[model samples]
Target chain A: MTGIELRGVEKAYGGNKPVIENLDVQIEEGSFTILLGPSGCGKSTILRMIAGLEKETAGEIFINGIDMRGVSPGAREIAMVFQNYALYPTMTVKENIEFGLKNIKVPKPEREARVGEVIEMVGLTEYMNRKPQHLSGGQRQRVALARAIVKKPKVFLMDEPLSNLDAKLRAQIRTDLIELHRNLGATFVYVTHDQVEAMSMGTDIVLLESGRIRQQGAPESIYSAPKNLFSAQFIGSPPMNIIKAENLEHGGASLPPGTVSLGFRPEKVIVSGEGRAPERGQISFRGELVAREILGDHAIYKFKTAFGCIHTKTMSGSTVEYGKWSVRVDAKYLYYFDEKGDVIK
Target chain B: MRSQSGVFWRTFGKACRLAVNLLIFAVFFVPFYWMFLTAVKNLGQTLRLPPAFWVSAPHWENFGKVFDAIPFFSMLKNNLVMTFGIMICQFFTVIPAAYAFARFKFAGGRFLFGLTLATMMIPAQLVFLPLFLMFSKMGLVNSYASLILPWATSSFAIFMLRQTFKQVPQELIEAAKLDNASEWKIIFKLMLPIAKPTIVTLGLITFILNWNDYFWPFVLTTNNAVRTLPVGITSLNIVDGGVKYHILMAGNVLLVAPALAVFLFAHKQIIKAFTYMGGK
Candidate 1:
């Protein structure tokens, strides 16, 4: 397993403005690193550049400490699983997994042996004779996995491989991919727009916005302590609730100077009846309950307050009444941001 | 009462549809029927006043007379060589050209594609004189090279296959590249197979068109040895300054049989190729 690095990478089509410019990124060896961003944010572009499927406008890329200039994607020792699964439609499942190995001139016996091992690893042996069109989405996705796994490349670059799978299957494959990464101990550079996939699967998350790295660190750190307003709002389900500093200050919360926005996790906020006084060193707001979304284990509450709508996630069957409610959060959990949306801390 | 009327109306509609279809079929079949009839008739029956619709005695020997009048096997060989040569050469030219036009975005790509399409719109009839002159200067006229080389590359195939190849997802090509397949392998193994229907349809279209192509080959070749079936068959129309209608019709029947046979066997594929043309 080897790490990957991109230096001063820029990408643009024709004379149009650059989609990505001067972007630098590094993936540690044996780490499941995620390139996470919104659509058109150039995460997939970066992955393609790493895989040498795309040529950057002006950049140097390295895989396993080897410069990738003039190195074809095949010679670079990387395998990619695409969003559409990209299984050779004309090939049987066995052939689809074995084609890559055969292309690199691996011996027939070795190719077949490796292909069989990967097929069994992905649990697709029974359907090995079936073409991709004949398989279900999950099964096709597994074939794509088997195709990449059989190559046994230094880095496995996946561009939203799990996005096409249904939710349950997505979850199942996520677990499988994590376990596979552990067992293979190969570097994985996965690109996805879904924050849930990023947070759940990536050991290292490189958060991106409009082609620039917003923050890069462990997924837990990126969630618990975001570097900017984008990171704060992007990582969590329902996102972190953001309120203007003036409103929070008016609601009797002390704030740092030049802090224009305040943020706190929705799950961190506590919802209680309106009559409950604010606890010491805690900030509270009184508002009418406007909506409730019961999500099995917990429910999300939306309240219309003086500043704006605020949301809180509370365990189901709580004692909060419908008409008026109080939203509270400990002062220590609140995040302060400046006018630039970067965290003040 | 409503159900009874509905059944009557449905039956009437079916009858009307059947009548229209049969009329259309008869209109198209009349030419082939006339060819077959003239092909089996003697010169006396063919030249009869008010044209006898049926012959009392069929003269099947007229078909044999066609081969004796012209170098039938040689002309057949020339046609086969020229048509299949153009087809096989097109695989060398059109597939790679169409693939490049479909996928690559080099400088002047749009203008180049525009030029390709512009050439397609110019009918081959318009280019024959200039092309014949070029071939004559190159000493290729009056030879098999003149016939096969002139129509070796087709603008129509490039356009059709370009449209189909453009619809092949870029992801598939990228996936192949990452899998260690070279560019040529991707084109031959992945793209050619993916574009099989279009290629087959194009091949059959080329076969039929060139099999019956008269003017281009006539403009180039003078001798019977290199002349294709159509030009050679024209000799049957006038042997020693006398018109032989029966023999010429028999020669035409020979020229048309192979194309018709191919169409009958692969009509489904042809229909499918056209139904999903451009992109699917």
Candidate 2:
């Protein structure tokens, strides 16, 4: 059974322009599905629709096979962790955790037990009596997580929950979330603009742009086999470099018809000595070395070529000279896109 | 050397601020001091030339004379009923209205809020004549309802609360909804507590405005049976006979005491509330 399903869902504030236009998504049971997109891409809007916080302008949503057309958010049996960690300011950590249970009329003993268990799970046992103001940013985030989990909702939705934390703390919480997802065995739909978070934690990734799904697949598959130019550029840091097919001087390889753009990941380019012979089905370009950025373990070398600026990632300890250099790209690693930006299969 | 100059400048600024504040306090404090002194002076001493700064023998009996001149207890009762009644009714009306203005998206919401604000600009004198006629037709004159009904919905209170409520993050409301809390629970439990300081400030403002209101109560009520303290105190100013200056001052003192006590109790909250408003 699907944990959550959105069929032809459309959301618009008013007038004719729909933010999310005729979208269909199915989150498989117990899978960690990530809604990944840049800001204002309507990823948070989709999460809100599923939680019944915002109504879809058209179409149906289902949770556990139950239609959620007019269901209140609470009745949908979905819990959401907000970016702001919206723990009730007046309530203590314990009260915030038990708030939903009390509202749903859960018995006293079970509610307390569940609150205690979830609090312990989040490692907030010592800070249970403190209000949200007294807790640090990370601690408040844990309280929000515990509050959502205590309800034991069938699905958990998080809207950039770790974005507010510092880098180290975000990483720590990301690992914690993954482990929690494994232990709970419940569907988790996380929304974030951070590609790193999506790649590290998501079992299935749905990439969105301007409210439309660009690609949906496992992290590795999306990274390796991006279906279009947007997916290629959006999924990677220092994004995929696109070189117009006209600018590239191919090494006697037959070009596909209707190919307007050729793309390759930064790490895919092989930097070698200028005199090295190009291997079979490999293209080589010799260009002036423009700049280099040392990123601890790896160095990114930017070169000015006839095609454009081509960035190559090499090991930091490599003793490569700074003048002219030959950069090689295997034909197999090249991605071709048509004028409409669709991949040329 | 820089630190030394910084300290000197800071102390100089502090001294200037203290001097200015003292000057402002004296301006406001002098009138209250004169009123207190006049309230305690005998009728003979009250009319003395240059006005006695302090009463030699404080006539506390003037306070008793105020009660004798008018039904003070009935007036107190009337004042409490009207002030509290308006406050309670305003709470029920304004909170939901403010919340709607702040959070809900609907057609004409902005226009209606603008209209409510527009009502605030319309002077009370402009509306009182029409309102008084309407009450007279309904035979509500000289009744607590007459005093309470017109002032029940305070536009200032609603406007202040809406601003405060808008500051509450939308995420909090969404979280509450996800927690199975109904709209009522969301307002009273979540929004209300978060807006407590503002509500207290509004309540304090409302209490003082209604308590010290002389014109409306004077126009609305005719006899001692329903007159509030401010209007009731006017009875001490006899038209045919000479005004009992000391007794009237004593009556004014009695009238001002409740508002003064309320302000003292909630001054901290009021200051905090205004600070929040200014910061926002």
Candidate 3:
């Protein structure tokens, strides 16, 4: 088990225009670290560099305190599962899982024993004779996992391995991966553009934006104390709505007077009951409910407020109407951002 | 009631498709039929008024005469040597070159590959005279080196193989690399296995082109020792005794047989190779 550390890693396709610049990250051993961001944020690039698939233009990579300079991907002692699974289509599931073993010159009987063990581990014993194309998306993903883990590599690098599966399968595999990590105790560095995957599966999340680290911490800490506006907006689902609102604080704390963009999570916002007024909440916005989406258990209401548009999720059984509504923002959930979109701590 | 016009239009479409396909097959297979007929026709029956479609007796001895009239065995050997040699050479030259062009990023690779593709558009005739002169200067004009050497380095093979190599997933190659495979193992074990279909197509094409080659052999070789099949057949056209039309046709059948058999068995793969390369 070994941790990966990137120090001042930078990459550019010449021309002095860097794709990833001055990036620093430290991933702990036996920890599932997800480099999460939107597309082209260079999360995948960082993963590739760690796998030695892509060369860093400038930086040093360390694995278990050993400098990983000028090392080829073959010698990296790391296994990577690609977004597409990247299984050898010509080989059967058994052969694909055994490819690395064969390459390392493992003896025939030991290789077969290891392959059989992983096949059962991934629940793919029945599909061992099948090719990758013959397997479903989820099954192929499992075969990829089986192939990676069978090697018992010091590090596992998965680049959006679950993104290709259907929604239900993605969620299912997410649970399976978390369980697998616990049992194996191998260090995992996962990269994904899906914030939900990062938040749910990663023990530590490294939020990236424009090829740089936006924030890094445990999932709960990053979710609650997001270091920046991008980190806050990116970490949640249905996204954190940003409304241009006035900080009309009469007696809170001494603050500068300037327009601030109010950020609050929709799940935290509550619609006041007909006769029951909201208390202990310092913020309330009155607006016309423009639209509503009833998603089985909860209904998300879209409103045109005085500040801007606000979205609040209320229980679907609640008797909220379309015309007028008062949404209460819990004081602790309200985040203020300056005009430049930086979080105003 | 089934509409009369709808039924008529449907029948007409089916007949049109059948007619078009018949025309295509005829256009492709007529020369082969004619060659086969000529190989078995006698001198007098070959020039008969109606152009003999059926003969009274099969002239099996005409094939023997083709061998008797010329050094058929030696000519066959030369053609086989050149064809197989070129094919084997291309297997080596094309696969690695293709892998490099498809998978790696080296300085000037794009410029070099572009230069290779640019050579494809230029006619072989344009380079024939200069290449012949260069080979003569190198004292390689009369040997098999003159025949097989120039073909051993092909731009088109590199181009075809590069397209095939590109279709192999980058992930597989990277996986192989991570397995402690040098680039050589990745090419031989991973890339080659995944690209079996494309490799067969390249081999067939390289064989066909070399077997049917005449102009290069005619220009470079002055004697029958190094002459390929097509060139050998042309020499049989104006032999010392007379125009041995039957013998010429027998030689033609021999020349076409191997290529025809290869194409028939692997036509789907050949067409797919064309489609794959054309798309690129």
Model 1 residue runs over 4 Å out of place are A12-18, A318-322, B43-57, B105-112, B239-244
lDDT per residue as tens, model 3, B96-196: 88888998899999999999899889998999999999999998986888899889968887887788788877777887778777767777777887778
Measured by DockQ, the strongest candidate is 2
Candidate 3: pairs in clash: none
Angstrom error at residue A2, model 2: 2.9
Please provide, for model 2 over B118-221, each residue's C-alpha lDDT reduced to its tens digit, 9 standing for 90 to 100.
99899988998999999999999999899899987988889999999999888999999999999889987899998998998998999998989999999999
Regions more than 4 Å wrong, model 3: A247-259, A273-281, A338-345, B126-142, B240-242, B276-280
Cα RMSDs, all models: 2.7, 2.7, 2.9
Q: After superposition, how far is residue A26 of candidate 3 from its true place, in Å?
A: 2.3
Under CAPRI classification, how is model 2 graded?
high
Model no. 2, DockQ: 0.80
Once fitted onto the true fold, the runs of candidate 2 whose alpha carbons sit more than 4 angstroms away are A250-254, A274-280, A319-322, B1-15, B50-52, B104-111, B239-244
Candidate 1 vs 2: which has more DockQ: 2
Cα displacement (angstroms), candidate 1, residue A188, comes to 1.2
Error of 2 at B206 (Å): 1.2
Give the candidates in order of DockQ, highest first: 2, 1, 3
